[model samples]
Target chain A: MSIEARFRIDRDDFTLDVDLTIPERGVTALFGPSGCGKTTLLRAIAGLEASQNGYLKVGDEIWQDEQKNLLPHQRPIGYVFQEPSLFAHLNVQRNLEYGLKRLRGVTPKVSLKHAVELLGIGHLLERKPHQLSGGEQQRVAIARALAVSPAMLLMDEPLAALDMIRKHEILPYLESLHRELDIPVLYVSHSREEVARLGDNLVLLEAGRVQAMGTVSELFSRLDLALAHGPETETVIKAVVAGYDEEFELSYLDFSGGRFAVAGKRLPLGSAARLQILARDISLTLEHQTKTSILNIFPATVDEMTYEGTAQITVKIKIGSVAVLVRITRKSASELGLQLGQAVYAQVKSVALLS
Target chain B: MFTEYDLAALWITLKLAVITTLILLLIGTPLAWWLARSRWRYKFLFEAVVALPLVLPPTVLGFYLLIALGPHGPIGGLMETLGGSPLAFTFTGLVIGSVFYSMPFVVQPLQGAFTAIGERPLEVAATLGASPIDRFFSVAVPLARPGFLTATVLGFAHTLGEFGVVLMIGGNIPGVTQVLSIAIYDHVEALEYTQAHWISGSLLLLSFLLLMSVYALNRRFSVVKP
Candidate 1:
C-alpha cells in the first residue's frame, strides 16, 4: 500500500506542486532546502493546507479528493511540529491524554503506556510542559501524537528547534520509534545527517518540485542530484552486525556490498544497523592496496562520474548491489584515470554506524 | 446613614451593572473570537466598530440609542407593533445602552487574548482530534482566562460608573431607573454635598478594587504564558 498525493498550492512568493506515491511503511523523508515547500507538502497531506485541486489517499481511505476534503481533525494522522507545541493549560499527563481520550472506538495501535515507555517520559508525567527541557517537551509531543494511534505520522523538522545537545538527546527516541513502530511516517527535514540515518525512502524537493524520489542509498549515490553534490553528501547502507572482536575493540558489519570492520560498538549480533559513509571520507585507488592502515576497503566498479564545481569530481561506484560515493580532487582523479565502468578499490576512512 | 433613595439607587446600579456585564460577555465573546480569527481584509472595520465606545462620547452614543429605542424609531416601532411599550426609559433600555457603552472594554481584551493564542495550538488540537468547537472550549477558553477576567471586571466597573447613557435613556425614575451615577448628579444639583459624597465614595472604592484585583490576578496568571 502507498499514500498518494497530488497538490497544487499557490502563495504570494512560492507555489507548491507535487504528485507522488510514498510507501506506506517506514520513514520517507521530504528532504529539501528552506522555502522548498517541505512543510507545505506535509500540511497538505495532513489536510491542514487548503490547497485547491488537491487529492490525497492513505491506502484505501480517501482523505481528500475533488468531491470532498477532510479537515485536519478528521484525518487519522499524527503530526509533530518543529516546536513542541504542548498545551500550556494542560499538565504533561493531560496533554498526552488529550488525543487518546478522543479516540472514537478506533482500535488503538499504540497505547498510552506504550508511548510513555517508548519516549521514556514516565517520570515527567505529573510535571507541566514549562518544567521540562526543550528535548523533553518534544518527546512528550511525540508521545502524545503516538498515543492517538494514528494511521500515519507527519513530522516537520521535529529536531529543528532544538540545539545540538538536545537534538542528540532526542535522536535516540526517534530511532527507537523508527525501529519499533510499524506506522508509516512522512518525515520532513533539510539535514542530510538525520535523513541519512533515519530515512528509508528519500523525496528530493527543490523549488516546489519533486526532483527525485528513491531509496536513500539510490538517491545519495546518484552523481546528478544535489543530494550527492552538497558538502554533506553521504552514502547510507543497511548492514547487519556480523561479529565483534574483543581484543582490539572492533565490530564486523556485513552488508550486501561486503563486510566492514569499524570501531567497536555495543550491538547484538545479526541486528540491522545503518552505516553512514560520507563522500569526503572515502578515497579511491587503481588497485587493491595491501597493508594499508584503512580497515574498510571493498572492490567497486565506477557507475558514473560528474564534476562537482571545478576542483573536485564525484564518483558513484557500485559495490555488489549497493552504491557508494567518493569525492576526489580533479588532479588526483586524472592521475588515477578514474572512468566509468573501471574497476577500483574504495578505502573508507571511517564508518559511522548509526544504531 | 444612607436614606432609602440612596439604598434604592445602590441596588438598581448594581443590578444594571451586573446585567449589562453578563449580556456583554455572552454577546462579546463570539464577536471578539470572530474578529480575532477572520482573514477578511476588512476585519479591522469590525474591530473599529467594537472599539468605538472607547473613544466616542457616551452622550453621543446615548443620543443615537435614545432615538433608536424611542417609540417612533425603527426598534421602538417594532416593539410597539409587538404590543410592548417603548424601551427608551426602561431598565431594559439602560442595559442595552450600557452594553453599547462598555462594548470595547469587554471585547478588546478578549480579542487580544484570542489572537495571542495563535493558530498553532488550534492546529495541534485539530491533529489531536479536537474539533474546532472542542478546541475552543478545551484549549482557547482556558488559555484566554486572563483576558476574560480583564473583560469581565472592566465591563462591570465601566457599567457601574455610567452616567450619560443611562441619564439620556433612563430618565431619573426613582426606585426604578434611578442609578448611583444619576443619584449623585441629582444630590449635587440639589446642593446635597453629604449625600453625593456617600454614593460617589462607594463607587470610587468599588471601581478601584475591581481594577486592582484584575491587574494583580493578571500578573499572577501571566507567569503561566498559555
Candidate 2:
C-alpha cells in the first residue's frame, strides 16, 4: 500500500512544510532531533492540527485534502501522545472500551479480546491509570488506540516520557506490533537506537524539512545523506539465515557483504533478520590480513570520504552495490595512500542483531 | 418566647437563602465557565464587574438595585410593561439582592475549578469521539465536582449571612423579605437578647456545618480518585 502526504502548516515560531510519500507496508520511523516538526506532521495527518494545504492518501483512501478537512475522530487514525494520557477517571478496561464504543459499526478492526492479548494488559483491566506503573500505563494507552481499528497508527514519541528501565520494559510489545499488525505505523522518534530496532523505512527530518527518505538500508548506505555521516551512521543490512556452525556456537548471517558468523542468536533458521553495523566499528585494511583474529571481512572499493574529527576520516566503501562506512585515522590514509578506486578489505569490530 | 413575627422572619431567611443560592448556581455556572475559558484580551473587565459586589459596601449595591427594580425605575418599569409587578420591597427583591451579593462566592470557586481542569481532558475526550457538549458535561463536569461543591456551600452560606443588601432592597417585610440576618437585627433592636441569640446561633451552626462539609469533601476529592 502507498501513502502520500504534502502539508504546509504555519505557527508563530514553527512553520512546517513537508512533502513525503511511502509506497509500501512497514513501520516508517519519523526520525529527527527535537523540534523537528515530526509531531506536527503526525498531528496534521491525524487532523488534530489544521494545515494551510495538506493532501494525505493512505492506501486506497484519501484521508485529508485542503478542500475537505476531516475531523480527527472521523479519520480512522490512532494517535498515542508522548504521555500515556489514559483517562484517570477510567479503569484500564474502560479506557480500552472508550475507543471501541466510538466505532459506529458492528465489526471492529481490533477486537477487545485481541487488543488485551496483544498488549498483554488484560490483567490490569480493572485497575486505574495511576494504579499502573509507567510502562503498564503506556501499554494500556496503546491498547486503547488499537481498539478503534484505525487505518494508520500515528505515535508521537510514545516512549520519550518513560524512564530507561520503563522504556526497556515496553519495547518488546512494540516489536510484537510490527510482527502481528499489518497496519502502517508512522512512528516519531529522536533516538537512533529505537529507529534501528523498529523502523523498516526511514524519514530523516531536520527543522521542518525532509532531509532524506528511503528504506533503512538505503538511507544508511547513501554516503552523501547526512544520516550516514554522523556517529549514529550505520548500515542496516537485511539478512537471512544461511546456516549455523554448531561446533563454534555461531550462526552464519548471509547478506550482500558475504556471510557473517556472529555469536549464536536464538532466531529460528531461515527467519529474516536485520543487522546494524556501526561505522566506528569498521576498520579498513588494504590487504586481506591472515594474522588478525577479526572474524568478519569483506572486499570493498573506496567510493567517497569525509573528515569527521580533527584527525580522522570516514571512508565509504562499496561491496556489490552495498555501501558501508569505515572510520580510519589520517595517518593510515597517508600511510596506505587511500583514495578513490582503491580496493580494500573491511573488518567489522562489532554488530548488533536487531529485532 | 418566639412570636409569629420571629417565626415568620426565620422562615423568610431560609426561603431567601435557598432561592438566591439556587438562582446563582443556575445563572452563574455558565458565566463562570466562560470566564474560566475565554481568551478575550479584555476578559479581566467582566471579572472585575463580577467581583464588584464583594467589595462594594452591600448598601451601595442594594441602593442601586433598589432603584433599578422600583416601579418608577428602569428595570421595574420594564418589568411592569412585561406584565409583572415591580420587585421593590418584595420577596423577589430580597432574592435578587442576595444573588447579587453572593455571586462572587459561587463564581470564583467554580471558575477556579474549571480553569484548573485545563484543555487536556477535553482534548482527550474529543479524540475519543465525544462531541463538544458531551465532553464538557461528561468529562469537564465530573472532574470539576470539587469546585461545584465549594461553590454551592459558599454561595448558600454567603447568601445566608446577607444583611445590608437585603435590608436596603427588601425593606424587611415580615413573612416575605425578612431573613435571619434581618430577624436577628430586629430582635437586638427590640433589646430581645434571648430571641436574637437563638436565631443568630442557629445560622452560625448552619453556616459552620456547610463549610465544614465542603472542606472535608474537598480534602477527599483533591487526591484525584482514579
Candidate 3:
C-alpha cells in the first residue's frame, strides 16, 4: 500500500501545490529549507491546515476528499510537533495514558508499555513535565503519540527546538523506533545530515513545490539535483556487514558498488548499515596505484560531469550498479582528458557509518 | 448589637453571591474561551461591553438595569406576556443585576488564563484523539485552575459588596431583597454606629481572606507550570 496526497494551499506570500505517492511502510522525508512548505505539506496531510480541495489516502482509507473532510482528531495519525508539548497538569504516566483512554473500542496496536519502553521513559512516569529536561520531555511527547496506536505518524521538525547535545540524546530512540515499528512516518526536516541518516525516501521541496522525489540514494547522487555539487554533498549507500577483521579492528561492508573497509568492529556480521561518502573525499585516477596508502580503490565508469565555479569539477561515476560522486580540480580533468563513459579508478579517503 | 433584620440581610447577601457566582461560571467559561481563541476583528467591542461595569459608576449601571427590569421595559414586558409577574423589586431582579455587574470580575481572569495556555496543548490534545469538547474539559479546564479560583472569588466578593444596583433593582425589601450592604446603609442612616461597624468589619475581613487564599493557591499552581 502507498499514500496518495494532492494538496493546493494558497497563502499571502506562498503557495504549496503538489501531488505525491509515497511508500506506506518506511520513512518518507519532506526535505526542504525553511518556508519551503515542507511543514505545511505535513500539516495538510494530518488534516491540521484546513487546505481546501485536498485529497488524501492512507493505505485503503480515504482521509480527505472533495465530498468529506475529516478533522484532525478524526484522522488516525500521531503527530509530534517542534515542541514537546507535554500536558503540564499531568504526570508523565497520565500524559501517556491521555491518548490511550480515548481510543474507545478500537484495539490498540501499540501498547502503552511498549511506547514507554521504546522511548526509555519508564523511570520518568511519576514526574511532572516541569521536572524533566528538554530531551526527556520530547521523549514523553513521542511516547504519548505512540500510545494512541495511530495508523501513521507525522513529525514536524521534531528536533529543531533542542540543542545539539539534546538532539543527540533523542536520535537513538528515534532510530530504534524506525527500526522496530511498522507504522509509516512522514518526517519533515531541513537538516541535511538528519535527512541523510533517517530518510529512506526523499521528497525534495523548493519554494513551496516538489522539486524531485525518489529513493535517498538516487536523489543524493543525481548530478542535476541541488544535493550534488555542494561542499557537504555526499552519496548514501546501502550495505550489509560482510565480515569483521578482528586483527585490524575493521568491518567490511559490501554494497552494490564495492566492498568498504571501515575503521570499526562494532557491526555484527549479516546486519544492514548505511554509508555516507562525501564527494570531496574521492579522487579519480586513470590507473590503479599500487604504491598508495588508500585501502579503497574501485574501477568506475564516468557517467556525467559538471563544473563547480571556475576551479573544481564534480564527476558522477557508476561502480557496478551504484552511482557515486567524485570532485577533482578542473586542471586535473583537462590534463587527464577525462570524458563521459571513460573508465577510471575512484580512491576513497573516509566514510561515515549511519544506522 | 446586630438586629434580626441584620441576620436576614446577611443570608440574602450570601444567597445572592453564591447563585451569581455559579451562573457566571457556567456562562463565563464559553464566553472567555471564545474571547481567548477567536480571531474576529470586532471582538474588542464585545470585550468593552463586558468591562463597562468596571469603569462606569455603579449608580449608572443600576439606573439602566432598573429601567430594563421595570414593568414597562422590554425584559419585564416579555415576562408579563409569558404569564409571569414583572421581575423588578424581586430577588430574581437582584440576581440579574449582579450577573451584569460582576461580569468582568469573572470573564477577564478566565480569558487571561486561557490565553496564557497558548494553542500548543490543545493541538497536541487533538492529535491524541481528543474531540473539541473533550479537549476543553480534559486539557483546558485543568490547566486554567488558577484562573477559575480567581474568577470565583472575585465574582462572589464583588456581588456581596454591591449596594447601588441592589438598591435600584431590588428596592430594599426587609427580608426578601435587602442585603448586607443595604442593611449597613440603613444602620448608618439611623445613627446606629455599632451595628454598621459590625457588618462592615465582617465584609472587610471576608474579602481579605478570600483574596489571600487565591494568591496562596495561585503561587502553588504556578510552580507546577513550566
Residue-level lDDT of model 3, residues A1-355, one tens digit each, is: 9999999999999999999998998789999889999989998988889787999998998999999899989889899999999999999999999989988898999999999999999999999999999999999999998989999989988899999999999888888888889989999999888888888999999998999999999999999988887799898999999998888988899998789999854787888788998999999899998899898899999999999879999999999989998888999999989999999999998888887
Point out the worst 10-residue segment of candidate 1 chain B by lDDT.
B217-226
Off by over 4 Å in 3: none
lDDT of 3 at A174: 87
For candidate 1, write residues B1-226 as lDDT tens digits. 5779999989999999999999999999999999989999998888888889888889999999999999998888889999998899999999999999999999999999999999999999999999999999999999999999999999999999999999999988999899999999999999999999988899999999999999999998888763
**How displaced is residue B45 in candidate 2, in Å?**
1.9
lDDT of 1 by residue, A130-171 (tens): 899999999999999999999999999999999999999999
Give the number of the best model, judged by DockQ: 3
Higher-DockQ candidate of 1 and 2: 1
Per-candidate DockQ values are 0.77, 0.43, 0.87
Query: TM-score of each model's B chain?
Result: 0.98, 0.96, 0.99
lDDT of 3 by residue, B87-185 (tens): 999999999999999999999999999999999899899988899999999999999999999999999999999999999889999999999999999
Q: Could you give the candidate ranking by DockQ, starting with the highest?
A: 3, 1, 2
True contacts kept of 1: 0.76
